[model samples]
Structures are given as structure tokens and as C-alpha cells.
Target: MVTLTSSTAAQRPDFAAIANWIKPNSKILDLGCGDGALLKYLQQKHRIFGFGVEIDDANVLGCLRNGINVIQSDLESGLSGFADNSFDYVILSQTLQAMKHTERIIREMLRVGREGIVSFPNFGHWKNRLQVIQGHMPVSDALPYHWYDTPNIHLCTLGDFENLCKQCDAKILERRVMKQDRPIRFLPNLRGKLAFYRFERQNKSPKSTQD
Candidate 1:
């Protein structure tokens, strides 16, 4: 059994809104898990058997101290070691923009889990749009990157992500947009700071599946 230190247990967010959507006692994989906060929260609150995959050494150690099980691996390499359908849900939160191969990573997430939850900063927020029109990079809470020094390999909008989901043959089960901690569903594309989506790969016909 894992044993998390008290100091490590105090940094998690109130993910109750998202946690409510997940099935209780489900096995979960959290990719790019920073500090393993979410994983610990899931374990304590939902009785989930959560696994965290993180690349940062400090964060990996922090997860261990927090009594969370974690695997240190680069997201760019893909989750090849895990068998298909190994988890009930695979989560990627706030790390999609940092990946160069977003589609491939998402595909692997779907293959390894029955369902996937993905959340990313929305580049189409009204403030971001306004900044673009004014010929400046947006510096908001969601996107704190400047044009010169930023880790984001790809910057995408809500519409862009939705189109990509359709093109990749993934079905969107749910979508939530948030500003700060409040839900903003009415005009998410224009107002939301973050966009969250729950998705599953569409079942293919036997012939297509074989191909």
C-alpha cells in the first residue's frame, strides 16, 4: 500500500465537479500528472486505483511522498507498455498544448482506456481573440506563455479541437467550459478559460476494425 506524506496531500484542487462524472472505484491513469495531486484526490475521494505518469523527477518524487503510485515516462514516447483497455478512464489535463503529437497521444489514451477525459486552455477565449486582433500574445491565466519563451508546441481553439475530434473518429460524450472555477457553458468558445471533454473512440465495423 502507498503512503503519502501529509505535506504532499494538501496541494490538490477541488476536482469534485470532474470527479462526479467518473465512475466510482474505476481504475484511472493520469498522464502528465504534476505533483500527483489529482491522482491522490481521486484515490481518497472515489476509491479509485489511480496511476500517475509524469516526466518530471521532482514531481515523481513528490507523488511518492504523497503516497501515490506513479510511472516516470515521457508522454512523447506513448503508452506502449500498458495493454489496451487497461484503465477505465485516462486523463490528460492542461498538458495537450505542450505536446507535439497531440493526436497520437490522444489515440493512445483512447486505446489504453475505455474512456478519456481531456482538458486544455482555450485559445479562443474572448481575451485571447482580442489580443490576437491587437497583434499581441495573450497573457491570461490559461495561457501564460509569451511569443518568445513558451513550452507550448501547439496552440489550439475550442472549434479546432472539436473538428479534430470529428476527424479522428472520436465521440464526445461531454464537454464543460470553465472560467476560474465557475462553469460557462453558454458561450464557451468566447468566454471560457478552459475546455474539458470526455470522449470515446467510435466502434468500427469488423471490416474496418480489421484494416
Candidate 2:
């Protein structure tokens, strides 16, 4: 029943796009919620009830100022406090590269929510490819950092993500690769700046059948 202030609704398009992807009136959990923009957008637009988990003190305070419900926690520690299927969706946006155990956190996302959406900068972007050929790290809008100063703990390509999805028993329901802000449909592994996927965890076999 929360509504966005008209001023906040006019801010940016990407947040609008993210808000559109969420199901209306469903529970959501946003991990690494930077500034709580996406959660506030969802609450205002779709009437979704959810809380954001942010570690940065400034961001946590920002969420409070924005009238968003949020929990202050480090993602590296995992989401053990939340029960399985506690939320309809769990979102991780532009924060995957900074995690130490990416796979484990992804699994936790699946366990806590019925479905999960993950978005990250693609290390195989065309510019990055060129940088590798030139023996230097690529610096672009999506990944704007020098190697020594970057907080990214893991670098992954599109192919790597596909393999990881397979290994984790997650089924991709929707995917988008973007160049700048435009969606890229062809050879995304080579041309895209970021990759987004909506996924669900595959059901496991019964214990009797497994044995």
C-alpha cells in the first residue's frame, strides 16, 4: 500500500525497467541493495512488500530516509536467517562480482526465494576482449575500475555464467545482455556490457530415488 512520491518516480529509466520485471503484490528480497532504489521503486509501482539487505551504513540510512524497509547485513555471511521460499523473488543486481563464494550465495538466493534475478557486468565484453589482447584490464561504464583498486573478487564471462547455471541446477527463465543501455541479442558474449537472468532452482530427486 506504499506509494512513491511523484518526484521519485521521475528519476531514471533503468529503475523503471527493473520495477517492470517484478510481479505485482509479491514478496521480494533485494540483496546488495545499493541505495534501496529498486526496492522503493517496486513498492511504489507494484505494491510489493519486501525488505532490502544492505551492508553499507550510508546505503542503509538512505533506505530508511526513502521510507524503505531494510536489514543491515553482509552478503558474504549468507542468508541463513530467512526461511526457504520466504520471498517470491530475490534480486542481485551489479553485485555478483564482489562476492567471494558466488556459487554459494546464488544457491542461498534460490533457497530463500521461489525465483531469483541476477545481473552482473560481463567480463567478456568486446572492449574487455580488446584489453586482454593488449595485455591490460578493460575499463568501461559497467566495470569502471583499475585492477589494483577494484573490489571485484571474481571475474566471469557469459559462457562461465551458463556453465555455472548448469552446475547449480538453475533454469534460466529469461535473459538479457545489454550494451550500454540497449539490449543485445546477438553474440552477447562478445558485445555486451552486462548480463541479466531470471532463474529458478531445479527440483531435486527424492531420497529413495536417488539411492
Candidate 3:
């Protein structure tokens, strides 16, 4: 869904913003954590303890090298194995758009952790819109694949994601739009390339699912 720009040597600025959001010593669960960069950063900057769930073997090895606790598991199966509110925060950075069962994953994230943070490439960015007008898939830093080959199966715009959150009764505590890792305050849907959302369930107890 999202690409890792730099190494653990150079931390992601948006994730730094996430670090600021979490309180010190809280527990975390990072979904699709790549190479344990965020977990490493959170420990150093916030003194938090946490685990990551990654399916990639190389990434799991990378997490071990980073001295971070990680679990190798598929996210599509959801967080059923974890106890309710097992973590203080659940993070799904830049991986939300690639998931096939996006709604289920969101609900599961809320169920397993008290709060959830997610980041994704904004599909409604001006460049993507212009490329649609030109009748071709846009290739850029945020979206770096050809139409057929892109790992992103369920792309969504900023508005679309917020609407989904509302439908699920998730309260968005914080939202940010970033361009070049800097926050964009004006017309973010057009200017920003990345969208970040931090949310929690309206009720910590799991809501009954009709389907």
C-alpha cells in the first residue's frame, strides 16, 4: 500500500507525529509494520512497548534485527487471536488501501486496541485526478506502480475514508494531510499526497455485527 521511503536510520516524519500522539509506556500493535522502523522509533522516543504483525519473512527478520517484538501473521484474518483491548494503540500505516477487507480490518483494529492510527496515499490528489482525466494510471512517489501491477486493490479518497469511519461509529480524534511529510492545512484533498487518521470506537466494547 505504501512504500518505506528511508531506513530506520531516518525516521518517517508522519510516524513521528504518531509518536507524539501516544503517551509514554503505552502498549502498541503495529499492523503491517515494515522492518520495525516505527516500533523502534516509538520505543526510543516514547518509551513504549509493543509488537508488530508482519507477514513478510524478510521484514520479520528485519524486526528481529531491530530488537523489536513482532508476529508473522496475515492481516486479512483479522485480530481475533488477540484479546479485547490488548493494546493501547493499533496502527495500520499506509497499508489500509491495499487490504481487500478494509472495513473488517478497521473494526478488528478497534476491537484489539483502544485506538487506531492509519495513513494512506490520497487517491484524490490533484495529480491523480489529472491522470484520470488523461485516461491513464498516475505514477508518482505515493503511487509507484502500473495500473495492473499496483498492490493497492481498494484505493480511497480522504472523504471516502472519513465516511467509512462514520458508518462504523469510529470517532476520528485526529486527522492530518501531508505533502512531503509536512502537514497541509489548506485544500488538503488537492494538495496533500498522504492522509493520516487517528480514531477510536465510540464505545470500547465491540459492537454487534449484523453480517
Candidate 4:
């Protein structure tokens, strides 16, 4: 089995932070799970049981190699295969911006799991702003793509994401804005390169089926 320690988790800071939020032995559904690295790490460390959803053919094979149960499917098609509240957490990491139906996906995530976690690049970072002022798209370690080739179609700031969560009736439970592995306490929206959020549907009930 592939083992990930705290030191290696630091390389992907979000994974470490997210792991802190999850309880041991919890069921997790990871969407856009690239190579099942996170899920594999979680399983080895947290003893988590569940599946991953990945669209890419190579990624699905990677998940298999990593000993993860994965569903090969497009996220835009919706997560109808899973029943309501089937898992402890549903995670979408750094892939929310590329989603075509963002709100729908969030709603589905909440409907299928007790809580949801999302992470994305912060478009409001000062470096990105400076690049925009210079009439060129920002390209950094967090968002390493040129204007035309970027997969991120819905780049947004911290504020934009919070507002969208409100619209979707998802209550923000915790938020971490950071530069790589370090937390930015001051002016996070402006200085942070990435954003991580933990949330759940507001007014949700254990027996409720309506989304």
C-alpha cells in the first residue's frame, strides 16, 4: 500500500489541512479525484472507505493501481449513482472552477454526503491582480496556464465563492486561505494563493430527500 506521511502531506498542503477536518474511518466520496492520491492517502491514514469519481481514463487506471474503488464518470452528468447521505464527506479539490454546472454539483454533493469540502485557486490574489493590471492573465504555481489553454472557466475570489455557497444554501463551516502550506491571516483574499472551504447544506435534515 502507498503510504503518505505528514512530511509528504506538506507538499500538498490542502491534503493535510483537509485530513485534519475528517474523522478517522469516515466514508468519503472524492470527485475529480486525480489518480486517487488523496483517497489513497486518506484510506491509509484515516482508514476511510468509499469511492472516487474520475473522468480521465488514465486517472481511473491510476486509482485502480492505488487500490481505490473509483467510478469512471463525468462530474457534469451528476452523482445520481450514490444515494442521499451515503457518505460522511464529498470532496472536490481544485476542480470546482472547471466545472460547467458548479451550483448543481455542489447541491448534489451535499445531497449525497453529510458535509462537503472544496478547494480552489484564489483569483483575487494580489499577484493575479497585478498581472490583470498589466493586461495579461495571471500564471503562478497555483494556476499554471495561459489564457486560452486554462481549464479554469469560472475563476473566482473568496467573496465570489462564499456568495455562491449562500445561493446554493450551503453554510460555510470553516475556511482556510493560504499561500502553499502557510496560513495567511491578514488580507487573505488579497494575499492567499488558494482557498479551502468546509460546508454543509443549511436547514438539512437526516431524512430529507428534497434538494
Candidate 5:
């Protein structure tokens, strides 16, 4: 798990970065929003209107305790509760790999909001690759789980995710790769253990009205 920073917000760096991308007073939806920390922080810092969707009972209670508007639902069912462009941003943080229907959920995110933000562990990091070379799955700070008990099922490299966005007709707006609290500038796929992306669906041009 990413460690919380000492800043007043006390959020993980990637969460803070995600917050920065959001505009003040915008409507936001957070998926798998454990404990509602990010949404609460944004409510206080950005004064944004935020809602959370969590499947776990404890987390749903946590969102209530945080005074965040939330609903208990499985993401696998998709975001059918919300209408198209219902929010300014929809976020799925560090939970993409665990999803059973990755493409469908991503499409749902874009469908329900103007933009989507996703973050996940980079399975192609050097440490993971080294472990693979040694015929073992990696056990690291970013992915601290054994193969059998791990929730993550469809882990992928940075390139894999980008290609997926393309296939979904999502336009990439920004991408960031990180190692702990710091951003990685060089050889991100090999060095960075985490990847973050902000994207939106492609728009079709309007037909000409002229005869």
C-alpha cells in the first residue's frame, strides 16, 4: 500500500495528484473508495461535491462516517445507477487489476462521467520482472500479496493499459508513473511501480448543416 504523506491532507501522493486534476466544485464519483479518504479530502480541500461507491460493508460505513454520499454496490454490475455524464470525474484507484471485467468497467466510467482516472500497480516493474526471472511472483510494497490469496488478477504493464484505452476509444489526457511519493521520469515501465492515467472518450464531429 502507498504510504500517507505528512502534509495536512495526509493523503498518498498519487491521491493528492488525483485531487489536483479535479476542478473545484465539480461532481466526483469514486469507485472502490476504501474508507472514503480521498473523497473526504477533496470535499475539505477542493470543496467538491463527491460521492462514493463501495462494495464492502465496512467501507460503506466508513463513507457515512466521513459524511460522504455513497451507495453500496458491486462495480461488476456496472454504473447503471448513474446516467451518462453524471459526474465531472470518475475514479478507480489501485483497484483496476482486481476487476473481473476491466474493459466494461472502463467503458462504464467513461459513459457515466466526462473523464476517468485509473491507477494500478505496474506488473512490468524491474523488481517484478527479476522475480519472474527467478521463477517467482514478486512480493513488494506495491503488490504485497501471494499469488493464491491475492485479489489482483489481471495485472498489466503501462503499455498494456494505454493500448486498452485506445481500444476503448478513450483519449488519454495525462499519464503519470510513480515510485513511492516521487514521480518517475525515465524508463517508467521498467522502474515505476505504479501508473496513473486520466482519460476521456473520443468525440465525433457534428455533421454539416449546409446543403
Candidate 6:
């Protein structure tokens, strides 16, 4: 009998902010939904019907114990299981950078869900540039991995992500940049440590599907 809780103050900050964007009773699919914390919070707060897709076995168990709906699967293989527009929203929180097939997964996200929300650490921050100039990989609280051992394989900047979105014909509905959970408005690429975007496909059609 395992259960999860988020009573402490130092818990991750994106759950509440992301919850604000979701409408009540709207269906949601959360990719990489660790321990179902954010899904649980949304259920308790917004009463939205939600499901989680997690790869880790421990996290799958945690989701079950927490009474959250979850599926265990690797993200890089792609999301071909869901139907077109099966959900009102699909969320990818802090998992985009580590993915090898970012473009493919993103396209799948938009295909399976009407709108997709993604958050990732911004690699274009000024400090990262400074570290490169000084000949050392940047290691910050948001991106705490050495270049050689980092899980984030395809890290992208704000500009880089925007260009990818354009290539995918994704319409950006909302954008937020932050420094340690607080908002970052001025010189976001240089100052912001985290970035979030909510978007939808300009044209609605499904390409990849699974039996």
C-alpha cells in the first residue's frame, strides 16, 4: 500500500501554473507524469478527468496508489496509441530536452490531443553561453547535468523551439518564461531558466496510429 503526498513547500512549481490553463472536466493526458503529483493536484483542484503516461515502473505504481490513471511507456518510441483529438490537452513537463525524437513526439502530441503544453529548461540562457565561452559546461539547479552525462540530449533554446514549432505548423497560444518558478519577462532567452509553451496544430489531421 503505497501513497504519495506533496505537503512540503519545496515541491516542484509547474503543477499549479499548468493547472490554471486546463479547463474543468476537460480530458488530459500527461506524458512523463512522475508519481502523478500534478494529475492528482488537478483532480483535487480542477476536477478534470485525466490520465498519466509514465515509463518508470516505480512511478506507475505510485500513480496507481495515488488513484491516478497511468500507463507505462517510453516517450522516445512515440505516442501512436492514442486516437486523434482524444484529449483536450496533452502535457509534457520538463521532459522535452531528454527526448531523442522531440519533433516526432511533439507532432504526435498535437495529433492525439487538441492542444499540447510543453515545458523545458532553456539552454540559451546567458550563463550557459558564458560557461561555453569559459570552456566549461554550465551546471545550474534547473539543468544539473554534466555535458558528458546529461540526460538531455537535444537541448534547445527559446528561438530554436519556436523555429521547430513553425516547421510543425504549431500555433503558439501561450508562452511563459521563468526564473525559479517566478515569471521572466525581460530578455527571456538570456535570463529565464525555464520555458513553457501551449500550442495547437494549425491543421487537424492524424499521421501516426497504433493497433
Best by TM-score: 4
lDDT of 2 by residue, 1-211 (tens): 3356755645544565466578899999999997788888887788899799999999998888878889999998888878778899999988999999898888888788888898888999888989989999888888899899999878899889879988788888888887755789889999888888888888632111111
lDDT, candidate 1, 48-146, per-residue tens: 999999999999998898788899999898888787788999999889999988888878877888888888889999999999899998888788878
Q: What lDDT does model 6 reach?
A: 0.86
Give all candidates' CA lDDT scores. 0.82, 0.82, 0.87, 0.90, 0.87, 0.86
Model 3: ten consecutive residues of lowest lDDT: 1-10
The alpha-carbon RMSD values of the candidates against the true structure, listed in the order shown, are 3.6, 3.8, 3.6, 1.9, 5.3, 2.3
TM-score of 1: 0.89
Give each model a TM-score: 0.89, 0.90, 0.92, 0.95, 0.92, 0.92
Candidate 1 — worst ten consecutive residues by lDDT sum?
202-211
The pairs that clash in candidate 4 are none
lDDT of 3 by residue, 12-126 (tens): 6777667768999999999999898888878877789989999999999999988889999999987767888889999999999889999999988888889999999999999
Q: Order of candidates by lDDT, top first? A: 4, 5, 3, 6, 2, 1
**Candidate 6, 56-153: lDDT as tens digits:** 99999989988899989998777777888999999999999988888888888988999999999999999998998999988988899998889888
Output the lDDT of residue 206, model 6.
56
The segments of candidate 4 whose C-alpha lies over 4 angstroms from its true place after superposition are 206-211
Name the lDDT value of residue 156 in candidate 4.
94
Superposing every Cα of model 1 onto the true structure, what RMSD results? 3.6
